[model samples]
Target: MLHGSDTKYRMFRAALLRGRTWLTPVCALACATVGASWFIADTMVERIAMVGSVLASASTAVFFAVQLAREVNRRNERLLALAGIVETTGDAVVAAKLDRTITAWNSGAENLFGYTAEEMLGQSVQRIVPAGDTTSLQANLDHMLEKDGMHTYEVKRQRKDGSLVDVEITLSPLRDLSGDVVGISSIIRDISERRQFEGEREQLLERERDARRDAEYARSLVEEQNRHLVELDPMKDDFVASVSHELRTPLTSINGYLDLMLEDDEDFPATQRQYLGVVRRNSERLLRLVGDLLFVAQVDAGRISLEMTAVDLTGLVADAVEGVRPVAEEKHLELVADVEPIEIPQADALRLGQVLDNVLSNAVKFTPAEGSVSVRAFLDGTHAVVEVEDTGMGIAPEDQARLFDRFFRTAAAGHMAIPGTGLGLAIAKAIVEGHDGTISLASEPGQGTTVRLELPAQSGSTESARYVETLL
Candidate 1:
């Protein structure tokens, strides 16, 4: 028993079917008349009678036949649309028609092969194949027909520019309603750019391998030369060491002689004595420079040891300011201190004092007449921040990074005719960092430079004056 909705659906299906133009109205009229006949027979005959149901049977058969035809047509339409979409896509679409001719192509195909529809349509599929690969394409087509599905390969393709490119091809068999192979559909992708990039990267790797070999060879040569040159440097260090020792020995004797002559009851003339004093002072400065060089050498040899202890940073600052006072006065610069009475953490007191003296002396030496040098300290969280600010011939930005490198003197210092051994800042940096603190400088060309030292602060008696006698 077909439902009413199912019966109407059958009629609608008949209306849309193929090769059954006359069947729809006939089935509709037949169904209506059969209903009427059944109604009349029940109304008039009253008694049981054999039902004449031929028209109802014919209407039902016609509905089924029409539905089947419509379904076949719909299936065919869907297959056609799927084929069209596949052939018109840009990822290298292609198709062959029942006549063994290339029939469909998309923009991707045209761009990849440089062939137009007018030139390729109705042409044999073999027309697009390179002469060397025609047999291969035919063999692939035969295999696809036998499998009834697809064959895929990565191969070379010839382009319109007479260049060859790598392509990945997928060929599927196209079949007719009877399942007979009528055509082939293919999807292709041009991977030329990716392949080219891979080739270039491989070439770069090869070049890098070659460069590394060359560099290794060059390094070997340099190492050999360095072995030969190693003998020359020891003599120079020995000479600096020996001469420094030689000069300091004689300078010590000269200083002793001057002191003795000054104390003599038959005193030398005052003018002569003053000249001798000047000689002693200049010799002492030269000796100091030599001592600094030796210190650097000792550090390089891993022999300079830091003896750590609680340092009164206030005292160090005050001492440094006092040590530079006469130099500041001679330069007519005001040297001021704004020191906090707070204690800093564990470090070598003598080393910290040298750091302060180096910076304060620099401030005095570089500041112009009537200019000022100031030392200030305060607590910042857990660190004691000491800043030495000066009104001086300021360092340039380009020279700032190299300020702590040994023997690096700036052009500004050279221009100002400042006499320095260029070891003070480097030594100071070593000492500050040795105490597990950080030192940094900030400066501009015409504006003064600020050397900031950040040292971790101590808490109480447990932290203060806890001198452990050891060596670094």
Candidate 2:
């Protein structure tokens, strides 16, 4: 890995040694010729002696001349080889004096700058440099001279066509035989394509940065919106609870007065009594709707308080089946109840009753004429299991997913014109989950519906409604 200068210096020293070796033989021949000249002129010994001294001087001169010629020939051959290399190289090779005057232009330089040697030679090197940027070229030359070494940098150069090209320039100071800096030789390589690619890469990186910033800003906006929703949730629950309470008071008074009026039917006409009955029924429905709203508000506000107790699932299931039996009979639907004694040591009897009532009522209400409703209760390991199945026009798969969502009515119910507030299953789910129980429904379109309720039979497994968090 010898440097350029180091290799050149070594070669020059080796050539000098070889020249001296050849001069030695020539020096011997010159001495012999001088001796022969001196011996053949014995008659004129004084003249021969002076002639011999002159011949000796001549021989010495000829030896020095032959050595100088060999040295000059080797230098010329080296210069020719260097010129060939410079001309054949792919990169531009330019030689210029310290005054920035171009001296040599190789073929590579011609191809790069669209200029011939005749056109560029003796011209200011500034011809190829970008206008008004000659300071950089001068500074580079000054720096190379100061350091006496090669320096490389990137710069823009102008071609003959007025187009600009990015180039990497390596400027090496050329030295004369005395090892003094005489000029600067430059190797120029086209890097326009490389710099263009780098520019595009930089643009892509900048775009990526902008996209990341936009994503972060979007995330911050979402988080801020979520915070506002979190703050407004309590206010929404309070409003619903207040409205339900106000409605319930008026509804209760209306129902009481209607009951008193309906008891004495003789005081009114038959048509008037019929109207009063309708009012009572409508009032009851409204009251029930208000109650559901209040309950839901309580659940939302985390204010549910359960009265836990040891309860028998067997009696509970029987009572729920009986409550829905009249409705099933009205629809001409068969109602069957199968019970086995199953006890839950800890539960809210009121809430458990509410859950059972909701399931059984829905089973009977959705069943068509001549369809059957079956209620089953049994002890399965440590759990009390209750299942209410109905041979009804069953719920669609899509609607089943949202059956326990408050105020979400099924398409089947809407199509059938069935009357409901859509809050029954939701309330039942909240109450069941409060006691650490699970309730599920299985149904397919036109098949049937099955509701399964499983509760822990042990006392310690259940949580009071007040402490429970209803995920629904």
Candidate 3:
């Protein structure tokens, strides 16, 4: 039995169809009545009156019949056009009875659901609905009945193979001739590709968010480490300063007493004299080591003072070369110098001497027997250039990167048992930079090394002096 609303729709359809079925019979009866009225006329006036009345009534019925036929033809043409459109369209067009029974299925529906019209017709609409979505389908139907109009929504529908697809379905009411809704017509569009693209876009956004979070976390860690280093730097400087001062006091006294005993060594045995000399030399070395440590600490604390004076840079290089030449001679290494007499307008002659001494000393100390060490000084425009080249065991590629870091010894130096504190180049760098100068080194393993220094020829202004002082 149909529901109350379904019964009403069926009754309205039946009454409307009965009325249309009787229209032609009524027209035929009107024609028969006109023929009888003409045959029964007796007098001339009566016959004319009957013919006129019958003719008028027959003409009215004929006009109505023609109008009805025209309206029916127009409606038939409209239905044919709509059917053609539904069959050819890409979107699925489906028609179902109010009881949810499938009535019509287009080619599009067959292609989308993998089911032919023959198989779907007379079947319940739930045949294509997923198990989880049956309730939703009923709800949609109820909503359509309540609204009494068209509605569109998205849902997942299962194909004949049981695979689900995303679809957009628009449901519209199908009405009878008496304007009573008896079925539902649905237009379904596949939306699988759009849904897939949206899913990928969301995943990409989530990945980008994760990357941003990781980057922020790394930056925060780096900042925290830098703060920790800054806090520990002062404590490190104080410890170095205290230790150097304590060592230097004892070292000075040892050197003084050793010097006195070495001078009077002839009064003792030769072995004792030799022992005293060893003690004296070791004391001097220890004292020098302590002094270098103190200097490094002072530089770290920005306590280095420079005494600016006009001086000849070439003369300074020449003096340092002479001082280290003895060491070169002892190693049987060739020492050479080329100075092109250039003067600096304002510089700390003493500090410049220390930088040159460190560089020249390293050259002489590292060169093998018969190897060559050369020093060159000249003026390049407004700058003074000094270059030192040595045919020594050159630094390795990896070690050259950190060659100027304090106390950083190279693998090659350690292997060869070369004596050094590794503070010379670092100190030289600080002093050269204090004068607003630049220094660079180039070397290759087993080949040679070249140290280059470029300093401003003239920086005599008071502001320049103050700026240079602050650097150290």
**Best-matching candidate per lDDT:** 3
Order of candidate numbers by lDDT, starting with the best:
3, 2, 1
lDDT of 3 by residue, 3-67 (tens): 22665334433433233322112221344454422211122333334443654655543343344
**Steric clash pairs (candidate 2):** none
Residues 284-373, candidate 1: write the lDDT tens digits.
787777777776766655567788777777777777878888887787776667766557657888888888889888877877888888
TM-score of 3: 0.72
**lDDT against the true structure, each candidate:** 0.72, 0.79, 0.79
The local lDDT score (0 to 100) that residue 63 gets in candidate 3 is 41
> Per TM-score, what order, best first?
3, 2, 1
Q: Model 3: residues >4 Å from true position, as ranges?
A: 1-91, 140-152, 172-182, 193-197, 265-289, 365-369, 392-402, 405-422, 443-447, 458-472
Candidate 1 accuracy as TM-score: 0.56
Top candidate on TM-score is 3
